[model samples]
Target chain A: MRLSELSKRSGVSTATIKYYLREGLLPPGERITATQADYDEEHLRRLRLVRALVQVGRVPVATAREVLAAVEDESSDQLSRLGTAVGALPHGPTTTGDDAATERAGRTAEEVQRRLGWRIVPGNPAHRMLISSLATLIRLGYPCEVDHLLPYGRAAAGIAEHELALIGEFEAPTTQLEAAVALTVLYEPVLLALRRLAQAEEAGRRFGANRGAGADPAADAEGEG
Target chain B: MRLSELSKRSGVSTATIKYYLREGLLPPGERITATQADYDEEHLRRLRLVRALVQVGRVPVATAREVLAAVEDESSDQLSRLGTAVGALPHGPTTTGDDAATERAGRTAEEVQRRLGWRIVPGNPAHRMLISSLATLIRLGYPCEVDHLLPYGRAAAGIAEHELALIGEFEAPTTQLEAAVALTVLYEPVLLALRRLAQAEEAGRRFGANRGAGADPAADAEGEG
Candidate 1:
């Protein structure tokens, strides 16, 4: 198929497709003529994955590039690398750059990897992006550690896995490809929305009162003194 | 006691105190001399409040001004207006105009007030900042609702109230004050860290499996056909 056909099918613009190609995000199609190119099913699959990472995941182009590289790497240790990358992100009290922070982040990542025992490629771009984001937050004065956040991350991961396992329960997609589509289009929004609701509820509880009025004057005096 | 003394007592910088005074974030202390000023406990209390709204709550300067105004208002409707301002934040779907965004934010503030039935004053810069952050996220394509988030906000507030209720929770000037410090310094980081963990877990579950496996031929066929 031509660029137009791919654009129409993928619902992504022609300009975007070109950009992806230029950025080495999407592989070049077979040259059919001086001005034409032929794209195959693989191109479409790549396109969808790109959309999932860039759009739904909200990853930046540079980071997305790294992730794509990891995905395509054929080394035997790729999976292990991927796992390390995912684990490296800042979660709780993990600091960035400083020796202590690095050690803490490394130890936590190793621990999580040991628990899961999954072969994942280290240096995954998503992991880097997440870690970078946490680092940025810390620089802006929010102190937290990755280990403290690990439990919640693990729980959320469990939920996501559960949701994926149940995808077969749906009748709309008989094949894995259709299932992937349904999962990407419908489930992504639903999961994100649900998470937002959860956070909002948590925020409310932290700032509001169920314990009754402001501080007593005597108590205030003691505290300030 | 001059401005420098007030700064030392409050643990806020002299420059910051000056900024606060100029911005009308703080009421004037007694001017005993042309160059010397006398600030009492009231000034200290207000400074602490200002810090809470600015640093911990991330309230913008202008909005903080408005909230402070509402806080100082003595009218019967002061509470209601305060509640409106505190709860009001730009939430819901995207809006193009600043006025529209402000109006939408006000509705969210009102919702928070209605739910908690607190006589929260308007013009709180912290409240405005929170609302603006939510709006920015929405604009960035994060699908979240103010109404949905209200529960989370309330939960945080509840926690704050409980912390305040703990007598002898702190050994010092006031347990409420101590609680406020702990809540601001510790709780915010913990909550933010947890949220980040949750998101990471979600991403992991979605992308962890079938990773490194080339597009499943069977799945690809289904998605395209």
Candidate 2:
């Protein structure tokens, strides 16, 4: 396959593919002639993965390279590789302010972990991210009590279990890691879109015509269809 | 209160508050004297919401203005206002390509909605967003069958119901709408962070030292604490 075919098959632009190659995010294809190179199926696969990481996941090219390196580093154990790759991936708001709120959020996160019976992974970035979000909530006068978050934790655990099982079915460690990155990044929109849709539906059920105080008569005609 | 007090209390800077006021995301304070104006608690509350929208939500100033307008539009009925506000709030990826896959995704979204027994609000942005996400999945060769998403929908609905109930506890419609916007934007990071944390924990359970292949002996020392 040539660069053009790689671009066509992977749905990435040829210019972007060349950019990746130049940036060393993609390895150089075999030089066929002065102006042409031959790329293999592995190149196609790698190109697709790179596209997913940079384009779909919105990962910085540098971070994507690091994650890709972790994915391809067969010398590292799978769990460590997974850890390194996910840690490199960005998550949540990075806001840092109000030391008291940060401390409170940290304690609350630990409590949630204890309640959920999960071991702390020392420096997992998600821990910091969780604290950042919780701290913002605390600063804004929102209740971020452990009890308020327990149900969300349970839901997250369930979803993660399902997703991990899916990843496990991929067999090879590299494929599993790639699937982990792809699924983790991509399925977020699926989950969030569903939540928004559900919010509207629940709102409609409560506040739409058949229901609550501000019910509109027009909405009654538009029942669940 | 004045701008400085509003900024001091809300933790937003005076320059940013002035920017919001200039952008009409926040209403102008009552003119009191040369270069000074008086602000009330309502100004404080609205400023907080504006900060949440622009800062935390990353909503553009223009979109924030529209959402704030919808929140303040008492002339509209509550449910309609809810619809407008949420509809205006950007939801998901806006990628448009591969018409066949997009049509397939649209059909799948409809099936999911019908399966969940929810009425399809015409032109609900989330419906399009759900389809866009599904279409992306399809183009990327991922299975987005309704069955695969039902669990997520259930989880989202459960979370949304809990959140809406909390919002409903606010007596005034304006307060409820403001809470809706705040919670919808702010808690996304909370849910996403929880999911990432759960992924780490679940991965640990499956692949950590106590468990599967490639497990690290060192991890065993760091048991649930």
Candidate 3:
């Protein structure tokens, strides 16, 4: 297929396709004559994947390139493929808190992990995320209870199972990496959005039309005590 | 307490505190003299919340200001506080897919909600997020199954219950807003990070040393058939 046909088929503009080519996010099509080029089915698939990473995942072009690098490297195992893809995601914001807060946060996360019986490496980014979040909660004096962590962790595991199953359902080993990449980036926003909607509905039931947000500060102070 | 004391106590610099004051995200301290002012516990609390929103939540200053406005609105209900906080979050990237993709995405979300008996309102931001994600997935030819949505929704509901309980545990209605803000923004990243780590581990167990990513495209195609 000609470059025009590739663009037409993929719903991407020729100019943008050219941009991806220059950035090395897309491979060069076979040179037909002088300025014209011919692409194949693989080019279409690659272009679609690039768009998914760039547009859907909001991954930077460079990062998308990096992710694709992992996807194309058949030498790596599935776990390695996923690890590389995840590593390519931008790291979260810097965590800044005092020593006490950091220590408390780390302890809470450790305790949560221990209680859950999931053996996460200390170096997992989730540890950083958990500690950072805990630090903020502690600093703000709204320290989360083990009550929340136990249930939250369990619930997260349930979703993780679904994610794994989804990845498992793909038949072609070749397509699995793409499925993983797409599913990994796509679902969080969906889950988060659902969470927001759920919270809003619950808030409506709890604090709407009567007591504001169900705030009974004296009761809270009692709980704290 | 002086601004210096506030800085030392909160771990925020005086310049940023002044900027918050200038932005009206924080109220001015009591005027003690021409050049210096006295901050009290309230200033300290407000500053801490500002840092959580700005540094931890990564909410933009304008959005943080909007959230603070919501937080300070004593008349609003807990639900209103949550709504305001969510509203203060910048909406996700603008969806740029064509019309068919949008329609299919919306239908997918609507179908999932219907199947799950979740009564999310049409205008919910999550709806937009869901639709947008669905659109991206569909446009990229990685359609998500109701199988995935059914479980993901249920899991999110479990976490939502915990969130509501956490919010409920707070006695002061005023603090509920802050709690909502913290939990609302904090947990998603935590959840996402957990999902990644879990996917990696699960991928390791399922496909790491064995067949690659369990991808058997013929089997998948058969299942589809």
Candidate 4:
């Protein structure tokens, strides 16, 4: 099939298809003539995968490129690379310039891991991202701590794992590629939406003054001091 | 004390405090004279809350303003308004232009809610956001569905509620503010990170790449026909 046909079949526009091709997000189709190229089912699959990563997974283009490269590289040590990638958790507590707060966060991470009985490999990128976000909160004088957040993390992780286990029932896309696309496209939005809902609920609880008292002095002092 | 004292007490910088005041995110302190103003503990508390909303909660400043207004409003309708604001389910999949795909999404959302045994609100802003995101993926030609995502959402909601319940265990201010803060700052990131890990594990289960060969021929035809 030609580029236009591929675009029609994929519901992607010709221009965007060109962009994907130019960015090397899609493999080069066979050059049938000076002005024409033919794409195949494999190209369609690759395009879908790329779309899944960028559109649904919310990954940056460059990062998506790297992920695709990792996926396609047969020579790459998949398990080791995946472990390293997964190991870089980014959701732990961030270090607020205060040594005490930083120490508290470190201790809290350890405590949470121990309590949950999950290895929770340290230095995960997601962990760092979350911690940095918390550090930003602490710097701004909010009482953001890992201990305050640990149970939620543990519970969420447990539920997420359980849900993933049930994905085995999704008999579609038995191949790793299909599974990858399905999981990435389907579950990513669900997770993102859940977070958004949870955030809204939290906001309602916080800014909605009817539910609780004014504030806590000791907690405030502990957070600030 | 004066604004500077309030700043010192709150650990929020003078510039930020001024900005907050200007943005009406914080209220004016008592004017001691034309050139001087005095702030009380209330100011400190409010400042902390503002900091929490912005930093830990990641609420945008404009949205924060609305939330603060809702918080301060003492009308009986305020609670209902809060519920309305937070209780919005995602919009059910639209059917006018893309009826088939949207209908499928609606079915998926319903199935997810049914399986979870919770009233998964449709058309909720978060749900809308997720659906739109999924639509974008479908537009980009990924064979992902809402039902594939239902379990994840259900599980996440369960975990979040469980975590929220645990917040009541803390004493006073910690319980009051920290619970809200923990929900906002921690829940989403933890859930998202865990979901990512689950995806990685699913990818690890090399169930063979041909499993998608005959399943969902309609999806394959629509997507790659």
Candidate 5:
């Protein structure tokens, strides 16, 4: 197949595919002539991954390039490759200012990780993400205690386990990496939407027609009385 | 209290507070004189919510303003207020192109909602979010079936129940709304980070030193056989 067919099959525009080639996101196809190059199934697969990263994941081309390099770095073990790829993806907001809040956030993140008995890579952006959000929650008067978050961590771990099982169905490391990256980015909204829908449903179940009976007895007893 | 006290109590800058007042995201304090006005604890609470929306949630001030209006509209029942506020928040990517893919994504989202028995509001942005993300996954060759997502939905519902329980602990509707909005925004990064950390941990557990024994027995059997 040529670039045209690759573009057609991948449903990516020829020009955008060329741009990917120029950006080294898609490795150059085998040169067949002065004006033509032949692409293969690998190119199509890589193109789809690149499109998913750059377009669907909304990662910058630079970040996508870096993630791809991590994916293709065959020297690294599969576990390390998956970690590197996920770590390279853009993180949520970085924490800033208020050293005390930052410190509190760090301690809480450590506590959750510790409670979960998981060893996270040093300086994974998720650490910063957890810190940033937790810090905000603390500042805003919400209970930022680890007790509130541990259940969430456990649930997240279960979901992640399920997702990783899906990724492991792929035989090749590159395919696994692509699946990991795409699913990680894509399933995010699915998870979030489900959470929101569930919130609405749960809110309805608890508070819909019975405002007087809204609060759980335990929670009601613990309210600001 | 005065503007400075409100600023100090909320940990928001006076300039930002003034900006919020100007933007009407925060109501103006009662005018005591030309250059002096009295503020109250309600002002402080509103300021905190505004800060959470604009800074932590990263919603545009305009969107925050709309959300705040929904929160303050006491004429609406608490459930409607919560629904309105969550719905007003900016959603994930709006899906584009490939009408067939869009239709498939919509059907899939509807199926998941139906399976979960969630009656999602007819145009909730989460619906679009699910569609956008599911469409992307389908385009990328992943199994976008509802079965693959029902577990996620169930898990999400559980988390949402826990969260709403926390919100329910608040006695006042306004306070509950503030907690709901802030928790919804702030806990997002926390949830995402947990999932990523969990993915890393689960990956290590399953694949650390045993490549041949990587997949779960069930998933292994289902691999591209």
Candidate 6:
């Protein structure tokens, strides 16, 4: 296979493939001549993975290279590899400059973990994200309480168990790690959309058609098939 | 208050505020002279909303403008305004030109909705996202089934109901729309982080130390906090 075939198979453009080659996100294909190179099936597979990481997962090229390196390093296990890939994910928000907010969020996150018996580390990005959200909620006067956080934790745990089990099938540690990262990042929209859709349905059931004061007829109409 | 005061109050820089004003993402303060303007509390509130939309929610400038336009439209009710804001959210992976995957995913999303009795439109971005994710799962040789989606839907619904109830506190339509949009966009990271963290915890409990052959000792140590 040539670079063109690799592009076709991976659904990545040849120019992007060359860019990846230059960035070292993809390995150099075997040089067939001065202007041509031969890509193997492994190259195709690697290109596909790189595309998923950079395009679909929105990982930085540098982070993608690090993650791929972790993936290919047979010395690391599945869980560590997942950590590498997750670390490579683009972060949302953090409490970098706001010390008060950071401290407040940190305390709340710690309490949430204590209550749920979840043993995540102190400075994990997820921990920071959860903290920052809570701090923002409080600042906005919403002040999310234990009652609010608990349901999300329980619900998230249930969904997580199911998703993890699905990816647990890949026998290869690298494949399992890659699938876990890909599925987690890519399917977020699915999870959130379903949740929002469910909320609309539940709202309709509870409030549509004058069933409640806040219900709008237009919402009901739009919600229908 | 002037733009400088608004910047101080909102924690957004003056340059960014000027940019937003130039971009029409923010309404101009009342004109007092050729070079000066007077801002009020209303301006402050609107600026906060815009900041939440752009900085926290990651909504594109154009989409944020439309959502704000909907907010200020005055004709739509709160629930309808919520619909507008939600509709403007950035989408996930879509099935453009991939008819086979779209068809396959459409069937699965329909089944998921029908089973759950959801009232979402067929071409909703979330529906497409669900389809795209499922198609990717199938392509990766780790096919997902109704069994997986059902649990996620159930859990997501539970979280959504609570979240909607929180946003439901705002009595004004525009404020309600803004809060709804803000919560939906900003807290996604919160939700996903919590989910991934929960997954890591659950994985530890189920497979970290001794229950499976692939269990890594370091994973066990990491799991134990």
Per-residue lDDT tens digits of candidate 4, residues A1-225?
999999887877899889999998898999999999999988887777666666545666776676666556556454444443333322334444555545555455445444544344455554454445544445445445555555556545554455445545545332343334445445554565665555444444544556547644234213210
Classify candidate 3 by CAPRI docking class: acceptable
lDDT of 3 by residue, B138-220 (tens): 76777576666877777776777778877787668767777778778766666776666666656765676565455542342
lDDT of 3 at B210: 62
Worst 10 residues of 4 chain B by lDDT: B216-225
RMSD of 4: 11.7
Docking class of 6: acceptable
Q: Best TM-score goes to which candidate?
A: 5
Which runs in model 1 stand beyond 4 Å of their true positions?
A: A9-11, A40-59, A76-225, B1-13, B25-32, B36-60, B63-192, B195-225
lDDT per residue as tens, model 4, B1-225: 898888777778899999999999888888889978898866776777677667655677886776666545556344344444333322223222455555555565555544544344565666565556556545555445545565556556655565555544545532343334434443454445545543443334333235434554233223221
> Residue A38 in candidate 4 has what lDDT?
94
**Interface-residue RMSD per candidate?**
13.5, 4.8, 10.0, 13.0, 8.3, 5.4
Cα displacement (Å) at residue B72, model 4: 2.0
* Superior candidate under lDDT, 5 versus 6: 5
Pick the winner on TM-score between candidates 1 and 3. Answer: 3
Which regions of candidate 2 fall more than 4 Å away from where they truly are? A30-38, A209-225, B31-36, B209-225
Give me the candidate number with maximum DockQ. 2
**Candidate 3 wrong stretches, greater than 4 Å:** A31-34, A94-98, A144-146, A209-225, B94-98, B209-225
Question: Against the true structure, what is each candidate's TM-score?
Answer: 0.46, 0.89, 0.85, 0.72, 0.91, 0.80
How many angstroms is residue A97 displaced in model 3 relative to the true structure, after the best TM-score fit? 8.1
Across A1-225, the per-residue lDDT of candidate 5 in tens digits comes to 988899878889999999999999999989999999999988988888888888867899999999999999999888888888989997878755667888888888887887777774558787778888888887876789988998899889889888888888888878988888888887888898888888887788776867535554334223221
Worst 10 residues of 3 chain A by lDDT: A216-225
Candidate-wise lDDT, in order: 0.48, 0.82, 0.74, 0.55, 0.82, 0.72
Candidates 3 and 4 compared by DockQ, better number? 3
Off by over 4 Å in 5: A96-98, A210-225, B96-98, B210-225
Q: Give per-residue CA lDDT, model 6, range B1-225, as digits (tens).
A: 988998887777899989999999877889999999998876777777777777777778998898888777778565566666676677676654465655676778887877775775765666666777667655433446776789988898788788778767877756666676777766677788788788777666554555456754345334332
Error of 1 at B213 (Å): 23
lDDT at residue A225 of model 6 (Cα atoms): 40
